[model samples]
Target: MGTSTAYGGPGGGTPLVPSWLGSDGDAGGLASPSAPPAGAPTKDPASPATLPPAPPTRLAIPTPADGSRFTAPRSNFTRFAGSGGSDRASLGRAVSGYVSKSSGGARQAAQRMGASRGSGARLLGFLTDVQARGATEALRSLDLEGLAGRPIDEVFMGLADYICPNAGTVDEGIAREAFIETIVDLSTLGVTDLDALSPDQMQTVFELYATHAIEARLCNDIGTKLVTAPTDPLIALRVQSQLRDFIRNGVSDALTAARAETPNLTQDRVHTFVDTIYERAFGILQTLGDAEADQ
Candidate 1:
């Protein structure tokens, strides 16, 4: 759950791309050429110099409307847990049932983003287009370029919006965060060339985004709603961490299973691929919940 402000600096020991790519640059882009030197003799109208300079290629900055925080529901469990009426097993069952019931809604949210005409599908189209064409061509089609020279984090936020298109929903926020996180992670994972990222790299990005989104969704859904917080602050943090890891394991398994079934992951099939992953992931989560209830 890193915030956008925390992304200002590159923390990894060494970036896979050139140092400049990870460093902050003139976000304003080149200022319009100084009015052609105040009436100095101009080149022929037909000459390249006479052509208007290309628009400044500024990376997009996110506005408040672009993203929102997940609003957790009031903790109904906390109300009764303090009275010694509920035990850990009952709490576990309540969490499992609640999350399992919510799985349908989560899957619907995922579908809205993954289906054709959704931002997630568009994101996949961009990646697959990169694979079919070159990265440069794909970017051009999307009106994005000069990425080789922009700050890595800036490029990340800009691209996140393009990929998820903040519908102002919690799910979209989760997806956008996941997209940026994937980029930040890739900076250390041998993704040396942003302008020419390979198809495998693009697919890796998508897959990681999906994993992060699922984990975030689960965490938001379960936080303090079904499980009461431990009194110790350190224990609370650890509990949260462990909960994330537990859910992430199930998500990973689902993605692995889905990937195995659809070995070729192309744009045409990305929607179905993602839908299958969501279905399997919720199923696995429900199974895990059932196990917890038994315990």
Candidate 2:
């Protein structure tokens, strides 16, 4: 009697296994010795309609645990000509020039106000005055009614394009460093009280510093670019508007972050803190502007 030819046997053309079973050995129970070998082309390739649906992709959202220090991605800005080397050097020069002049102005204002660099309270008061006067003068022309409902950061981000249209032209790294240095100088003026804040609150504070630093650097770059015609009233107003919006948004973002991190943080306390920081930054700019005019 001849051997049964139900499965592939000698001189049999039929495969021992079905072609639908994946050829990989790891196909688990679905795989069988009767399946065709892996990598073998199918006579009729599987159509998209026949394939199983792909699993959905999930997006990860950043949380407070991710840390509060957020740096903008470098790719967000355009690369400078000759790559980053020359661009960086140019940006460094601009930062150095602005910091030197602004620090001198701030020191002079501090002395005149009888507020030592270490006196946080007196310095805060002085900054408050400056901010009020600067903001009043800066926004006297523009209609700000539309901005009342927007998030502080969103408003500032929008003004970023108008205030410092050329900011994207500078190297992001150099601009970031300059901004960080400026924030440190503000700390020397006793603007921030680190001991009073919780760790999470401190993170929010640093995030605000980082945000404003970038904005200030952009303004500085804009000023440097306009050195030839600095007296243009229109240009000055535009820069002032940018600075004001930057301060406003920086304070708002810090408070918002603080609230998120510390649920117990009261809205009233956040408002007070935001007001203080915003005024202080605005005042500093006002003094800086005055010193520049005198020079």
Report how far off residue 109 is in candidate 2 (Å).
Answer: 34
lDDT of 2 by residue, 122-172 (tens): 222222322434323323333433543343343333333332222221222
- Model 2 ranges with Cα > 4 A deviation: 1-172, 175-179, 188-204, 216-228, 232-247, 254-258, 261-295
Lowest lDDT 10-residue stretch of candidate 1: 18-27
**lDDT tens string, model 1, 159-213?**
6657766435444555666666667777787665655666567666666666656
> Positional deviation of 225 in candidate 2, in angstroms?
4.2
- Which prediction has the highest lDDT against the true structure? 1
Query: Per-prediction TM-score, please?
Result: 0.57, 0.24
CA lDDT scores, all candidates in order? 0.51, 0.33
Candidate 1 residue pairs in backbone clash: none
Error of 1 at 41 (Å): 62
